[model samples]
Target: MVTTNKEKDLYKKLSIQVSLNGLSFCILNRKDNKICYFKKVDFEKQLDPIKVLSKIELLYEQEEQLNQPVDEVALLFNNALFSLVPENLFDEDNAASYLKFNTRILKTDFIAFDKIGQDTVNVYIPYANITNYFFDRYGEFEYRHSLSVLIESFLSLPKETDTPKVYLHVHKNYYELVIIENGKLVFANSFEYDTKEDFLYYLLFTAEQSKLDPEKFELILLGKINKNSEEYKMAWEYIKNISFMGPFHPFTFEETAKPKEELSEYLLIKSL
Candidate 1:
């Protein structure tokens, strides 16, 4: 089949989301605003950076969709080593200082920040080796903290009420809690858990600390979670209102790449 330039341009934007627990990638046809490809790999257990890189290398060698040439690439790193700073007080020179209080950092570790709107900056650590690998392959690409994408996308949603709403983005072993009120970010934090009780504790604690009543406020779940999941069952026992987040972006998907759950790849699909 002869490939036209228009066809070549269709799948030019690639967005990847990586973490210790898993990795997901999405290929976007910008001209038509459609997702041409999407795939996700979940590790049995959290792997170290080196092992993660190896997995990524193996994936590139095996996944034909990833081999396509692209005009733009975006990498979103998901990890606990991140902090949000008010834009006015953020200093680029002291990026490490902002994270040191909450996250342990090595002297040799590289730091990066994503400017979220005009009011906040997300400071975190990106895997240097993995980034270098992408650099070698794509020449140049954009990368950001996964929280930045989540925050930005959630903030873009239309406000339904003035009451504070809790958004829980669940992962394999961790979850991000974001509370927004009247379309503004009220609080955001990531919590790690090993049991359903731990998950409930964090959710309730966050609500209490934020002075949001679990019975009154709406709780929207995203990522790898559903009503049937243990986490959801546990949350439902205490939290009176709970629901899953739906797709807010306009991008459509090819049948082969369409996600079974529209909310499953929330961060990766929105990263583009």
Candidate 2:
């Protein structure tokens, strides 16, 4: 099949996000302001370093064979030492190393302790935040960051108008509920809890701190969590302000290149 230059370009560039347990990758046509394809992969069980890269390479080759032209890649991951394998390991002679082909990794779950400049915080992310700790900190942090990026990207879409849009992200690990008023993050915060009572307390505490009336603003939940979980039910029993985000899935991207199922999915969410 004779693929056009435009079509080939569509397959070469990818926006990828690699999480502690999964990968999410997407193809974007920046010139056209369009997303050509996307996919998600889960990699929680495999621990071998070589197996991981082999899987990633398989995905790339699959895409290429399908006539996908991907020359650029964007990767996202947690800020942890264990996940930091040397960039050279994934290389094959003169070929591309997964890290080298895409070195732009945005370390999520990081908080700046010292102010570096205007609006820039010198942040520090707990290693535990992105690792297999006593608690599910890494998963929680990954989900939180993924949800944030997803919401931000949606809001920043080219055609979005200049208006306020409220959002809520519910992860198994955390909840990110916020409002973006006129392209500005008017209010936002993350809460943690295991019990219903604790969750309610955090939400109420956050509402008060943001100074936004729950009755007036819109609320959304992002991840795979029950809005009707007993805790969620009890909290909203009297409060009629909050709303569930979607019975909808994120916009899916179709592509020619395929990665190891796990890495592909992880990168897909990151890039989203």
Candidate 3:
């Protein structure tokens, strides 16, 4: 794990992000809306999550913040193990059977649920170690699909274009696409890709399948994508109006905090 910020001894609510190859933690002081503590550990390659999280728990074991009452922790899961079910037809009794169709259901998997948009509910797994750690410490907390936080926050923005707009939030090996039109959700899905060709193909294909002209539709890129990466170059070759997403309102980092741009929404969306 690489350390990025100086020590801040403030006690605050925790926000944790768990992914296939990494984990992040942020401490938020709600009274002043400040991000007092932040740390992100990116793995060189995929590691066993439970082992990684246990190591992480030890890394921060002495921090006073962990001792504080953290019943209000927010989780942003970064796996493909998530499904969006319509609220009207959502079956609590058959969640495992339903999600099995989209993603595999492991025996140790514990279902984490959250309400995303007005009509949809997200069923996802927060992985075993994450759930067990937070529950053991906080007793009760809230969880959300990492992608749902991005989409829900984006839809709250004022309408900007008459044409369809696609939001792509890229992570280590997956990306989320959300289409909006006239202030309503048009399409929302996640795609995983390994090569730049695969990434661009999914982006363009989704737009085309949605009947959105890649040349005309606007694309907002978020998460770990970089301007120097081939993913951006290939995407720019096909789509127009592609721009990086900005931070959520009312979130501030201390002069020394050095908040990460990639986790902007992940850090502040729960508060929003």
Say which candidate scores most in TM-score. 1
Better structure of 1 and 2 per TM-score: 1
Best by lDDT: 1
**Count of clashes in candidate 3:** 0
Per-prediction TM-score to the true structure, in the order listed: 0.93, 0.48, 0.86
How does candidate 3 score on lDDT? Answer: 0.73
> What are the per-residue Cα lDDT tens digits for candidate 3 across 119-229?
877887777777677666666666677767877887888886687778887777778888888887878888879899999998888888898987788898876776887
Off by over 4 Å in 2: 1-8, 27-69, 78-151, 154-166, 181-183, 226-232, 246-272
Give the candidate order by descending TM-score.
Answer: 1, 3, 2
Model 3, residue 242: what's the lDDT?
Answer: 88
Off by over 4 Å in 1: 1-11
Worst lDDT window (10 residues) for model 2? 134-143
Candidate 2: what lDDT? Answer: 0.45
lDDT of 1 at 83: 94
C-alpha displacement of 245 in model 2, angstroms?
3.9
